[model samples]
Target: MLVAIGACYLDTILTTPYYPGEDEKLRATNVTRRRGGNCPNTLEVLQQLTSHESTDEELPLALITILPAKSSITSQQIRSAFRSRVNLDHCIYRDGFEEPASCYIIKSKSTGSRTIVNYNDLPEMSLEEFTGIANELGPKATWVHFEGRTPEMTLQFVRYLRKQFPSIQVSVEIEKPGRPGLQELAEEADVVFYAKTWAQNLGYRTAEECLREQSTRTHEASLLCCTWGQDGACALERGTEDFKHVAAYTTENFQVVDPIGAGDTFIAGMLYALNCKRKDWDLSKRLAFANRVAGMKVSQEGFKGLDRALLSFG
Candidate 1:
């Protein structure tokens, strides 16, 4: 099973008509609340995509995340959402903090572009938490995936894990770059996945450029992947002949209801495809699958628009 570690947020997304003037007040047409946060979102998508044909077996995925002692969301809600697909034997429910972190996402009616206002009071998971979970789950986990929002904390956790067990493969999703002490973490990651926006945030023209710069500076992981919306994705493997480009799937006729978690869904699809050990499928194939998953996600109105059919392994 793949183990994903990171924070989980509850997202509040609003869809409304565009207002032309600053003085004009706009009315929201729709609103949605759903589970979010990079790692859980991606892991959830993976779970949906890799469901078994029969109900007898569980999906080959697990999530290790933090939750408050008492949640507005009921225990049944949590169980119904993830327990079937993910092995939560190492999960924790701690007694600190307010309601889970949440985001206020706004989508423009005219352009379909989105703006998000997020609120988070993330409590850093301690080393003891990491070691305890790792000791229990590391031996059985084939892959460890972390979303790079918590750089220092995640780096320390991953570094410790690698030192204790160098055999497991580790993948990192670099959501925000230019973070202090990030280069060291990059050097230790087995694979790095990034988006164009993160590259721009780091002052690079593109994600590929950022990856190239990292390769020049560090003797880190060999594989770098950059996901581009609509246009598709690109990958650079160390010592490989050249860079590989993956084209996005066509979505000309689909109606896009929401696009909030598309990128996370795309990453989940890629990870799922990789874990399936489909060596015959190239990077392009993976990206195509990812693009399809993302496009399908946007066609739905809420986060729960994700269903078993979208994640069909068949």
Candidate 2:
């Protein structure tokens, strides 16, 4: 079982032909509502890529997210949104919080960028609560992924998890730049994922440059990956400073239909590549495979058919 820790958000997405100017009135072409968040989106994509796509019994993909009260309609919607592949049996539901955290997204057709505004009144998960969930997972879990948020609490949980479950491999995503203590968290994770936003925020102009220069900041044995949209991704094996880069996959007449969750999709694909059944691939090949998966994601509307990302590789 691979356990993921993060929030469960109700995402309201609006697609417009172009980014709206300040005070401009432009009606959106489409409006969609769905269950979203880093953990859910990644696990959902991973579930789709597996051979047993309909059940978690063969390959358990579980989420440890905080949701609204179990009785709320929003919570029910979030729970029922995913297919049977993702196990939600270990969710934490707050009694007093009836409304789920919301993410309002504006996707522009012309720019291929998603502008997001988030509103969350729900209380953050405490370290104690996460420990309880970890205890429940016990010896069943093989890998645990953490979304970088509530950095202080997450940091504590990561350390605690390492001490408690020394056999379980840990992976952490460093997506947001403003969050403190992520640097420390990065040092502890076996694999660390860095978004372009996170990289660029630190004055990095390219993914390769980021890995080459920032390699010393993390632990010696940690593997670091930095994903730069369109240009593809670069990774570094920290111990040996073994760096590799893979270009973005694209076909003739390629088009980007939707960019939402592309990073999360990349994370899922990378996780699938490194931790899934196919483990003999080299660093470059793994990045290439993940690049294809993520590239395929942006070429379509949503996560459907991402399993086909393995077609050329297979």
Candidate 3:
């Protein structure tokens, strides 16, 4: 089993400029809405990739995300969005909160570039809340991924899991650099994943530089991965003789509808392949599979039509 921890949100996306200034507004050329956020999006991809194995296999992936607050229409939409992919047995529904977190995304019609505005209503999960569920899933989980939205809570969860199951691998996705006490968490992680942008934000010129600096300074992490959009991804393992670079796959000339969740999908594909014990040389195959899913997502209006594309990847 693999566990992902972070926020889940309802995403509203517009493909054209909705407004230029306070007085001027523009109509969108395209629009989309979907269930999004770090954990949910990543887990949805993992679930899609892992859920159809033979019954003799271990239980499929599990997620530990907070459900939307009671009585919110967004909650219903969120539940419905992931109904097919997630098991619901591992989900937690909070009673008194007013609304779930949400993201408003704007994409440039010509460039496929996007900007996001987010609103979060779910508070960080307490240690007690996580440990109860971790105890149930820990023994089964081979790997756990954490997106740094709730670093303090995530660190506590990692600590508990390490104490309970020392062998289980923990991967941390560092979305931002300035989170308080994040370095401490990075030192404890087995793998640290970051996008090229995040690596740049940390004052490193390249991913290799970032990983080398982190490995030298902390010495606790084993692996560091940096993803470069369309360029490829690179990984450096501590105590290894050299770095490994996996080039991005070439796709048939196709249009990009939305690149919003491409990175998350790529991570999911990588995790799926890794967990399934696929060859490292096949990493590009997994990335290509993810890119295909992301391409299909953009061509459509929402995240609803991905089941076929995601499952079609062998």
Candidate 4:
């Protein structure tokens, strides 16, 4: 089983031919809404990839996220996005208090860049809530990924999970480095995925430098992975002095629709391949598969063909 912990969002995705400047109003080329957020995107991809598996057909997925305050419309939309296999019974629903909804304005024609405006008014999950659930389901999951947010609470969760469920492999996405608990979370996580921009924010010149720096400082992280948009990704495992770089998968033959969730998809693909536990596949092979998965994601809108692409991989 795999569990993903973090925030959930009702994303309003807008597409326009070109990005508008100040005070400019233009009709949208397309508009679609869906359940988004780092955790949800990864969970959704994992759900799809595992759906076709014959050996692990019964494998379970649990999404630990915060629910909006009794908003039926938003709540239902979020639920509808999750697969039937995902366990949502453990989520925390903030009662009476409404969190600001997340919205994304994407310019498809102008190189598929997106402007995200989000408000996280909802409270982060308390340690007590997480402990209660972990106590009940400690041995069920073999792997867990966290969307690094609410640094204190997230650190607590990771600490507890490590202390109690020592056998479980933990991976954390350090997407927001400015969060209060990131340093601790990174130090404790078995695998840390650092965003390229976040690495630059921390004064590292390149992903290799960031990984190398983090490798020297942390004892728990066996693998540190970083993604560089068109340049692809690179990773450095513990005890290694050199970085392994993999070029980005090409999408020249296909139309690039949306690249909003490509990173999450890459993480999901890598996690899925990791959980498969094939001894013959090394780090570069695994990264190649993840790159292909991300390429498939960017070629379409909203996770289309993700499952098929994953299964089709050699």
Candidate 5:
């Protein structure tokens, strides 16, 4: 089973001609509403990729996420949006709260680049609650992915998972900056994925350089990876100074309708490959496979065409 833990939000995406000027009103070329978050996006793609892998038994998936305590329209939308196979019984609903929402403005006619304005007022998963779920999933869990929310709590939870279930692979996405204990989580994770823009903000010039620097610091992780939009993705293992770069599959003949969740899709592809194939793949081949999957993602919008995208890969 692949277990994902993090925040889930209702995302409203708007496609505009160009970024608006200060206090200037503009009309959107297109609009889409969906459930989007690091964990959910990864989980959705993973589900699509692994759905038909075997016929004997179902590949189980469980998503541990936060939601509103009271059943509201947004919460209902999230519930309806999840794939039928995803187990959502473990979701924690915040008392008397509404789900957080994010708005993305994509300059579709110009650069296809996006600007995200989000409201994250929901409470984070508590350490005790996290431990409870981990204990239940100890035997059946094959992989667990986390979004770095409360860093200190996340570190403690990951450490407990390592001590209790050493065989299960643990991966963390560290896109958010300035959170305490993030480095500690990186140190404990089996795999770490960093966002290119976030890494650049920390004074790194490129994703390869970021991977090299992070590879030196992580004591536990053997694989350190990063994603660069349009520039493709790169990775380096522990004790390796050189990075293996995978070129992004071009969208030359296709339109990039929405590129919002491509990174999460890439991570999901990587995890699916690693779980099914283990170490049979080299770093570059694994990265290349993920690159292809992400390329398939951007060629379409949202997760609507994801199944077709994965099948096209076959």
Candidate 6:
């Protein structure tokens, strides 16, 4: 099974024709509430792509997320957000926490941009608690992707997973640039995923510029990938001096229905193409597939039918 480790939150999203200016009150055209967060958004896409496959033949997708205490309404909503195809057998229930972490998003329809404000009150998962679940999932895990949060402990998790489950392809999402120790985790991971905003924050103007420079800092990253909004994505394989670039998937309609989970969808698509059931594709196909998956996500309201993006490959 493929496991994703991170925090999942209850999301409140609002849509408006345009982002309002400072101190200006704006009315929303619509509001949507659901379960979201890096890991959950990713699993929403992966579960669909791998859904209905016999577990005996395919590696199932599993989540290792922390949630509110069992009795909370937020916890119940989270539990009900996904289908039976996703394995929540290894989730962590944070006791004494009644409210789930929440995110409020304001999206601009005209520009397809979103402003996000996250509110997380629960405590971070302790190493002991993390290991308890990782140990059980280790033997069955073919690949594990970690959301880059709680940098210090996350770095430790990478080390422990490496020592305990060396055969697994460990991937780390380095979306938050200010998170200290993320570089260390990136150095240890077999795959490192970079975010465009994170790269821009570091003064790099292009995705290739960021990956090519950061490639030297990673000691063991066999694959380094980064997605830039319209420019698409670029990746580098270990021992290669040149980077491969793929253009963004363009839909004829040119519509961006939602951008809230586009990045998560990109990561999910990449994981599916690189290590899931149809993993044997060459690097070019893998990159293109992920691009199309994300393209499809932005063209829709949510993750429903996001897996159809893969149908083109067949």
Q: List model 3 lDDT by residue over 22-41, tens digit each.
A: 57677887777778887788
lDDT tens digits by residue: candidate 4, 1-314: 88999888878888988888889998898899887898889888888877776774445789988887656567767777776889998888888765535766565577678878786677778889899988888799888899988777788898898899999999999877456668778899888888987888889887778888889777888788888788788888786654688887775577677888888998987887777634556888878887888888888888856888755667
lDDT per residue as tens, model 2, 28-68: 99999888899998988898877634344356788988888
Q: Model 3 — TM-score against the truth? A: 0.85
Model 5 pairs in collision = none
- Which prediction has more favorable lDDT, 2 or 4? 2
Residue-level lDDT tens digits of model 1 in 15-73: 77863366777889878777777887887777666664244433378878776555545
Tens-place lDDT per residue, model 5, 213-246, is 7887788897988998878899887756546898
| Residue 3 local lDDT, model 1 | 88
Per-prediction TM-score to the true structure, in the order listed: 0.86, 0.95, 0.85, 0.92, 0.92, 0.95
Extract clashing residue pairs from model 1: 49-311
> By lDDT, is 3 or 5 better?
5
Deviation from native of the Cα of residue 108 in model 2, angstroms: 1.4
* Model 6, residue pairs in steric clash: none
- What lDDT is obtained when candidate 3 is compared to the true structure? 0.71
Cα misplacement distance, residue 64 of candidate 4 (Å): 0.5
**All models: lDDT?**
0.71, 0.85, 0.71, 0.81, 0.81, 0.85
Candidate 1: list runs displaced more than 4 Å.
Answer: 19-24, 52-59, 70-76, 96-98, 302-314
Candidate rank order under TM-score: 6, 2, 4, 5, 1, 3
Name the TM-score of candidate 6.
Answer: 0.95
Q: Which consecutive 10 residues in model 5 have the weakest lDDT in total?
A: 99-108
